[model samples]
Target: MDLFTESGILLLPRDTFLTDTHVQLLQKQRIWEVEVQQVLSEGTTENITNQLMDLDADKETVAAYVKALDKTRSLFDGIGRDDKPGLEQFSDVFYEVAEQSMKQLGLFRSLYVLEGSDSYTYRHSLNVGILCSLIARLLKWGEERIAFMGLAGFLHDLGKMRISKEVLLKPGRLTEEEFDQMKQHTVYGYEMIKQMEGGSELLALCALHHHERLDGSGYPHQLKGDEVPVECQVLAIADMFDAICSDRVYKDRTSPFEAAQLLWKEACNGKLNIEFVSHFVRYIALLYVGARAVLNSGEEVEVILIHQDEPMRPLVRRSGEFVDLRHERTLNIEKMIG
Candidate 1:
């Protein structure tokens, strides 16, 4: 049967195949006693029942996420208009979502898996915010600093609102002129934030320098090493990770493992902070320890363990056998299926 939240948002369509992950997500949303077709064989029913046992659930988290997305959409829609949203407006909504996201990693993980393809900007903003906060927590920062990091990440792309949709949404290689205009988003965001109430120089600078790299290879001011603030450094990692893992007009989404590898590569090339990349990439790799993935060789496997030295190349289980990616260097995880 079809499932809808109390707020009337469709949660799942009728007859959707319920994987173990799906069931766990529903349980997290406090959804129990779902009506399903009685077509499962006796053995399948027993297996599902066993998997459903001892699950924890919470409804508010999912509801808060939906409301946060709606709020984000509304705020983005008002950009470039007379009633553009202020820093306070964005913070108010962001805190609500951040509170829910911090409750558990599962909610944050589910967001990536269940996200729709539309509204890329709004979704990207929210996801980056959550990721920034997560990275801050992983760094053992104080609560206030973590909150600031999230806000910084959330507003880092505000300048994109000023770009012409024709250029922003173009699906092919951009003309040199178009690319130059696109790069101005940092400047635009900086100006916009500077004008907003409660927006500080640091906040505006985050929007300005988030694209800046350590190797003097970044734009708006090719700042190298310490020229970029530590805050902007963190924002750069979160921003790049999300962009690579997310679908864009011109490219398909890469898997998180692959994205982590790329981040590590960039760090090694002096474009990103190697220490920060090491910490964040290890966490990202560990997050998918139990996930299902398709390897480059077309074999489906379940990640069984993450090697600390090579988190991206984990030990995986395939067809009742184990494949140690560390030794099987020819094969790599192509993408996650769930």
Candidate 2:
């Protein structure tokens, strides 16, 4: 039998036999009961029964995420058809998810683990929006600013709707010409936002400059350092984190641990906001403290502690033995297996 949270997150696929660890996870989440199918007589009858189980207790959060993703897909489809969806429409889609993000910190932080069949653009938009809001709160921003930041992140990639399907969905490397066209999404998003009712200059600029980096390597205008608005700086960090950590058409997803390392490196190289990266990456590393991961050396390890000095390199337990990643520089987490 298949198992899923009330919010539609798949916990166990059909025919998956539950293990003790699975039950423990479910119990930890407060999921006490689930419906399962029992087969009898080799095809004569299938019986459905309520069985004991347990898991994370964020059905509301996961459900809100699933609903927001659906709405995002519809909104993006409208944009593709040249239909201008207003700020109110985007807000309606984001508020529920944003509210959930504030309450269930555990399940909300692991939302990416519930990836479904939704297209990349729609899912990325929603994830980036949630992440941007989280980062804003981490900065101790007020409620009003946090809400606006979430909206800005939701609309950051609106320009991609204008790109042709062939260029957007190419399963392989893009040619130089195609890549140039792709970069125009920032400009297109800026223009689209400017035309929307109630869209402010900051919102429009966020669409335009979210890709702009501190080192002048970004596209659209190459704005650097203070030239890029602080709001856009926050948006850029969320955008890059989601893009790197989530699966895309041409690339597999990298684990959040490795993704944080890359973001930290970019910050140190003057390409990203160092302060933002530092706070965000440390939070990300700490979020998975008890999560399991596979190392480059093929051993599975459970994260035990996050170092304050180097959040990306934490202490982990492998086969009941502790290994400090800071001392073992050559070994890094390759993927998250949980």
- Overall lDDT per candidate, in order of appearance: 0.81, 0.81
Location of the lowest summed lDDT over 10 successive residues in candidate 2: 44-53
How does residue 209 of candidate 1 score in lDDT?
A: 97
TM-score of model 1 relative to the true fold?
Answer: 0.81
Quote the RMSD, in angstroms, for model 1. Answer: 11.8
- Tens digit of lDDT per residue, candidate 1, span 35-77? 7765211122222122222223245666666677667766765
Supply the global lDDT for candidate 2: 0.81
TM-score for each predicted model, relative to the true structure: 0.81, 0.81
Every model: Cα RMSD to truth = 11.8, 12.5
lDDT of 2 at 32: 93
Pairs of residues at least 3 apart in sequence or in different chains that clash in candidate 2:
26-54, 26-55, 27-54, 29-55, 29-56
Could you tell me the lDDT of residue 313 within candidate 1? 91
